[model samples]
Structures are given as structure tokens and as C-alpha cells.
Target: MTWGKVREIRDGRCGKGRAGDGKESGGGRRGRGVETGQSLTLQSLTQWKVPDLGSGEGSQEGERVKSGGICAERAIAKHRAQRTPISSKNSSDCPRTPRHSLNMGIFRFRLMLLCLIGSLSHLNSSVADEAEDISHKDADEAEDISHKDVHCGVPVNISHGHYEYLSHHDDDTYLSVIKYACDGPVYHLEDPEEAVYICTEHNKWKNAKLKYKLPECHKVSCGVPKDIEHGHFEYVTTHGVTSYLSAIKYTCDANYHERDFSDEGVYVCTIEGKWRNTDLDFEIPTCEPVLCGRPVVHLETHQRVVGGQMVVNGASPWSMLLRGADGEIIDGALIAHQWMLTSAHALQGEGRSEAEIKANFHAYVGIEDAREMDSAHEVHIDKIFTHPKTKDAMVYSNDLALVKLKENITYSNHIMPICLPAHDLAAPGKVGHLAGWGMGVELKPATHLLYVELGMANASQCLHQLAQKQPGLFTEDAPDLFCTQRSALEENVCRGDRGAPFVVEEGGVEYAAGILSYDEACRAYTYAVYTNIYNHLDWLKEIMANH
Candidate 1:
């Protein structure tokens, strides 16, 4: 018979029941105490007759509750197959009941059996449908999760540490499946309806999944110079572009280093979940020349002897010269023609024109008296060149300059050349002198031409004392300039003594050296910013050739 015909027969007994809607009347709840023996027998017959239906019966059975009921019937078929057959001879003691009574009883039993089978079939169909729905829902959720970690790629055979979970054993049983995988044991759980989640992978899930909601990173900055010593960083982009891994680490080149306190080359994560490297190398600038010391002079006449041996004078003949704008006959070695190499602040003055200086000229070298100054070389200055990046207006570490002289003097004891300091000689704490034609009393302006000297002070003492005196002058710039003061208060460079000479005595050879420059408010204290003549020799030479 067809599945439809069989269903019709069952419905005739149960009075027509639907599977999904649970709309079967009188088949549920009211007949729980009724005998289940007849109902089990009916299920067995249904299962036995299922295979006898048309081939299409399988599809029809799946569409309704018949398929699950068939399973139950099959389960009963085995039980029935084990029953023993009775012999006709032994049936003589059978009661002689009326045919109508017997038929009614059998019909009533069949009705009850059909109702019970229908109910069980309906329940099995409901469970199967629910399971199918759950499977589809799980698949959709897994798809969404996979899309989020598209960049992380497929998580293969990935195993995590210990985790916690909840499980519903049954109406009376509870379980706690802490770690479902791995060797972790399961425990007894209480709540059945609540969902169980493992918190062990929270951090991993946050970094890999939930963190995607963070802001998009445009640029990643490395190194917190203010807070860290050194740091290394590594990162990979999870957005639009595929397969992006940041290989560039933040690190300083050799001979150069970062001042950050973070460990060298460590990767740090930012608020955007991106990473940066903060490793840098400390740089060591190339060493240059040392331009310091005073120009040596003839002890008998105190006249400047230009080309001679002093300190920092390498084999080179070019030496730095510094002269006072005032009548002070302060001297220094001549390093260049276009640029007068002297103290850094020596040029701190109202640069005078050649005519203005000539008009107000009072004294000249080689002449004993102003009246007989005709033979003395009158060097006219045109422009003063001071370093642009000096420390401050008054103090400078790179105390040097380039003075444009209108008339170049031929080499002589009074106009001779000096040596330029090399790297070895130029260093901190070196001594130097300052000479100028400034007034003895700083209160008055510079007057008649005269020479004075002061010994070189140690670089450390000069820097320390100067910084104490002028709190703002101690910096990277001050260490480069040398310092000195007048040997005697009676003779010192005053206001107009700027651009004078600073010299020292050694081996009886007079060397043209530093320039006389800045002094404290009173003549009681003075400061001479030294010159870097050797380093600027080439720069001076190039400018002079073109000029």
C-alpha cells in the first residue's frame, strides 16, 4: 500500500493528526494513563508495512511524522519477531464471546494504540526540526566569525589552554564541562537553560575579533623619546590590502642612538591595535679643529709676532686673528683674508664702513706715535661675519668670525701668519688668552691704543662659572667657545674692545690666536669667546678666492 493509504488508515483510528503544529485532538495529555501495550503493537505493524510501500514512500515519510514513527515500529518489529506461535490444539479453551463484542473491543484497542503512536511520532518530528534549525543557525554564525578573521587566515588545529563550559545532562542531571577539548575534566553543572562560554581565550578573541571595531590606523609612530629608552615594534595590516606585514623596525643607525629609555628595538601596541618600533642609535658627530689660546708677542715691545708656534697650531700656516675695534691693540693670528677668524662674539658690534673707521682713526701699528702713523699699516674693515647659529646675543660656544679687510697686509713680525689648530689640539679645558685696547675702567669707553692680556681658563671652569654668572649661556654652544679674563684689572678690554686678540706664549714663538669679546657689566669680570680657525680655514679660503 502507498504511504498516503497507510496514513489514512492510521488517521481513521486517531481521527486525523498534524505533526508540526501539535494540533492533534485527544492524542496528547489526556490519555497518559491508558495502556501502552496496544499502542506499541500498532507501531510495530506500521514499521513492518513501511518497506512494502512504493519507493517514493521514503520521501513522503520524511515530509511528515511517519518516518520517525517507522523507526519506532522497526524497534518493535524485533520484539514481535521474537514472539512464539500458538498451536490450534491448545486453543480449545478459548472463551466463546460474541463476534460483535470481540470486534468492538479490538476496534477500541486499535484507536487507543493509534493515538499513542501519533503523539510519539509528533514529538520525534519536533525534535528533528529543532535540530535542523539549530544546525543552520550555527553555520551562519560561524560564517560571520570567519569573515572577521579573514586576515588571520583559517585557525587550524588550534588548541588553547584551560577553559570553562556549562552542560545540561537532563531534567535531573547537571554538568560543568570546563574544557571540552584537551585532557581537562568535566564537572557537575547546575543551570540547564543558560549558555556556557570559555573565558580562557578572551584575550585572544579580543585581539583577533572584537578589537576590529577599533579605529583605523593611518600612521604608526615609534619611540616615546620622553618616556622610553628603546622599543621594537612589529605589526600586520588586517584591512583592505591583503598580506601586509610591517617589516620596518624603528631603530637608529650606527654611531647614532635614541635617547629613549625603552628597551632597544621593542614593539609597542597603540590604541588602534597597530604596532611601532622604537630603537635608535646615538650619533657621534665628526671631530673638528680646536681654535683657542692667545697670540704671542715680543716681550720687549709687546708687539704681536704673527706667524709662530703656540697651542693647537698644526703644521698649517693659517692661524686665526682677532683685533679690538677700540684703540686696544688686541691681536690674533690671521686665518683668512676675506674672513677674519677670531672669537665667535668678536664681531658683536656695529659693523663700520671703511670710510667711517678711517675718518675716526686714532692710532696705527708700527708707528710709535699717532703723528708718525703714516708708515703703520691701517687695515680698514668692510663687513663683520659672525656665526648665525651662535648660542645667544651675548654668549656663544662657537666663538669665531670672518672679518672682510679692505687692505691685506704683507707678512711681517707685526703682520705675520699663525698656525691653525687640528683635531688633536682642539678639545675641552684648553687654556687661551684675551687682549684688547679697552679702557681699564669699564665705565668709560675705549681710548688710546694699548695692549693687555689674561691667562686662559680651563674649559670646565669657564663653562661652569659662565653658566653661573649668566644662567642662560650654558648649553651645547658654550662648550665650543673658550673663555678667559684680564690678568690685571688695571688693563682689560672694555666696550669698544670687541674683536680684539687673545694669545698665549710657548716655545718663544708668538702665535696669532683668539679674539677679545664680551665682558660682564663691570670691567671687574670679562669673557673671551674663542675661535675655531682651523675648521673654517677652507671656508675662509674659498670665500677669499671668489671675493
Candidate 2:
């Protein structure tokens, strides 16, 4: 009755004959329907007795099969249960089939039922094994998917910027949001709208506004500052660093601001990456000189004059006196102990030969009064060197000359040399002074040294003005020549003003900024042109080096 260790005594298949031959075998023999231990069930269903019929003996019922070939066993060993029951009389009922026949039919039904139960048990075991394997496979696939869609961690850091997480489930998990900001006022985000990013479900950090792309942190750059006309700018934030939200200061050169324009202190690099003045809309400030009328100026009481004003003695120690034998006086600048700067045309006095002019010309320094030549130090000329490109024309472009003195002059309050244009910044529209003994009233030479103040005007405007008087004199683009502001006075520059030293004072020091190259007719609305000393520095340095 141990079902687990039961043996199959019938054929492996249900409702059939013996496992080998189709014959009915007798009791006491096992069937071959199944493997060894599976061959017997209920002890082969044979040793018990059935009701005897014709012979009053036990029939060979265990192996009996009907013509239809279905097994009908009627007897088996009931010894274990130790009980056997024969059908009793059914007197009133129709006569029953023989008791043995009835027992065989009941046995057959029980045998078939047991075979079916065994078949179902095997099917259930196979189904359970398959179900367990499918469950394990599903778990493995779920694990791989969990690894692939992992939550995002902290994103990469950006230069000049930082990020911080907003409300989220975790620091850098999915659906987390982060805000971006620049490191300082000197830097800005490239895109403000994209400053917030999200940790996406796809395990990536993405911009809040964009679907797939990651957010970017970019440092702003305000490229190179715009070029200022007649002026310059410098960075106050950092050297050679124009990027970020930096700052700058713009300033005009010397003489550039006579009256109109003024300085704007702080120019800043904006979030949009542009250089701009927070107060003004202009990107660059300009140094523009007024051409027609005199630019209004604030002059010191002692220095209020511009048209041949007489000053105290030794006021212009660097002013040189150049006189012709026929009493012609020309103004010059004393540059060194032995060197003097003048107009190249000064060497060509009207009536004197070149050799005679060199020998007879008298040069003096420390002369405030033209009439007091005896008190001035007279230096004889050792050599007369005019610029090689000097033109003896009405409008001289290279109207520069140097006179080498025979003796080395000593420096004193009344006889000092002026500085060369080296490191001297001559700003347009800034006033500069000129010292000379100009031709006085009615073509008479002045009895005292005179000086005048004039602004250094723009070269382009000066050329235009000068071209109206002498169209062929200048090409209007003279690089070495520069002009002064027009005088509103009746006589500002006259005949005796030629080669006068134009001194520009900066930081308490005086520099020889120009030499008078043109003389206007001593009338109102007249402007004079000069040779720019800065442009002639190379030639002067070359000459000084050679000497």
C-alpha cells in the first residue's frame, strides 16, 4: 500500500492485455508493463478466491481478458487485509451473473482507476518542474533590467561655475533637479534658461528645457575691447584677461579733451559678453577737436594768452634765438647742450649764401627780451644739418632741421634744454605753448620774447583747412606734419614765429612737441601747421647716435 514504492503489475498503458504476449497468463507471475519497481500494484491482484461456478474451484481470473481485449482480473492476494467476501444470495432479484463473473468486473474497474491516478501524478510532477524553471528565468531577466536603468549620480563639474541639487529623492538620482550659477561676478552662464538640469530616467543629467541633451555650463567672454579714436583703454580687472564679466577704464590721450568730452570711469563686461559703459551707450569714447571756432578752455592767469603774449624772463629756457645777418629773427628749440631744432627753411635766409649764413648766423639762449642779446649766451654754429627730405615749398612736409653748436651749453634756470618727443604724449585738442619773438605791429619785430597757446588739432581736419589755401602744398595725408587749432585773434602766428619751439607740458615737465613749419598772415581765423616732433624721433636718434 506504499504508493511511492509501488510496482506496475499491469501493462504500462491503461486498459490492455499483458505486457508481452496477448495470451492470458496464470497467477503467480508479474507483468512487464513498467520498469522493475513499477511492475506490481496491490500484489498483482490474484491470490484471493472468487465464488466458484461450474467447477466449484478458483478460476484463472488474474490474467483473464475478454474478447474485446480489456483485462478483467477477479482474484488477488487479500492476505494482507485477511478478508474475502463472496456475493450472498439475491433470491428475489433476477439471478445475478455468476459471482466469479461479477468479481472479475469489479476488479477490472479498480485496476483501471489506479493506472489513471499514476499517470496523472507523473504529469503533475513534470508540470511543477517546468513552472519552477520559468520562474528562475524571469527573475534573472528582471535583475539585468534593474542594472541597466540605474539612477544617475552627480554630474561632471563645470569650469567657472557650480551646481547644487534642489528637492529630490536622493542627491543625484532620477528626477533630481540641480541649479547652476557662476563662480563670481567676473563670470556668467552662457544660457540662463538652461541653468536648471534634471537627472533623467535614462541615467543621464539633462537640461530642464531640452529632452535628450545634457545641460552645459559655459563661461562668458567679452572679446577684445573696441578701438578708441585718439584715445585708449586698459583693463582694470586683470591683465591680458578680457574674458568673464571684467571691468575696464577708457581715457583720452594728452590734449584730447579740451572742453567737450569727459572720462567715463567704469566700463564693464556684461552678461551678454559685450564691453560697455554702464552710464553711456557708446562702446568707445572719441577725442574730437572742434575745428571752426576756438574750443573753450580754462587757462591759468599767468598762462591765459595765446597770440604773442609777453611773459617773465626765463619762462621758456629752452627757446632758442636764430638771427640772420640782416636782422631776421627765427625761433627754435634747444634740445641738447649742443643741438637745436628748427624749421629746415630757417637755414635759407633770403639774401645770405649758405656758407655765409652758417658763419654769420647768431644763435642765443636764455633770452626773454629780444632787445637784450648781450645778456644771452650766444653759441656759434658748428654744423647746419637740415632734414634730407626737407622741401623748400610753401607747405613743407619734412620741415625739420638741427643746428649743432660750437660750444656745449650749460644748464640753468634760464638756459635748460627741452625734452625730445620721446615718451611725450601729444594729445589732440590739448593746448600747447609756443615761444618766439613774433613780428610785432606793422611787421616790426617784437622787443620781448612772446609765447602763444594752441591746441593740437586733428591732422585730417588740419589738412582740409590748409588745402583750401594751398591746394598743391599738401596731399592732405602728411604723416610727419600736424596742425594747431585756428586762432580767433587778429595775429597769433606771424613772420618771426617760424621754427619756434612748441612745448607741451605734462606732469610738470616740458617737451619739445613740435616746430613751427607754417606762418599764417597774423589774422583771425588763421591756423598754423607744425612738424610733429614725435615722427622725427627716429631721425633725431639716428643723428644723435652717429654724433
256 Cα displacement, candidate 1 (Å): 51
List RMSD in Å for every model shown.
25.7, 21.5
Q: After superposition, how far is residue 251 of candidate 1 from its true place, in Å?
A: 68
What lDDT does model 2 reach?
A: 0.64
Cand. 1 Cα-lDDT: 0.40
lDDT of 1 by residue, 1-547 (tens): 4666545444443222323222323333211221222234344544422122112424443323333333333444544786744433323333343335434544565676578667657866898899999999999898667544323211122132222333332111111222222221211112221212222222221212323221121232322322222322223333222121232333433222333322334443442223444432232112112222222223233324321112221222233323334543333335443345544443443454435543544323322122433435456656655555665445555555665666554432123344444342334444444433344442553333444445555656656776777686554344345556444433345554455555444564445445544554235565444554444556555656766
Off by over 4 Å in 1: 1-297, 300-339, 342-376, 382-384, 391-395, 423-434, 441-449, 473-477, 485-494, 505-508, 521-523, 526-528, 532-535
Question: Candidate 2 residues 158-263, lDDT tens each?
Answer: 7777777786535776567887777766666666776788777678777757654544555667787886776677889896677656888776554343223223
lDDT of 2 at 304: 45
Best-fitting candidate, measured by lDDT? 2
Cα error, candidate 2, residue 182 (Å): 90
Cα shift from native, residue 162, model 2 (Å): 99
Residue ranges of candidate 2 with Cα displaced over 4 Å: 1-307, 349-353, 393-395, 423-426, 441-443, 487-491
Query: Best TM-score goes to which candidate?
Result: 2
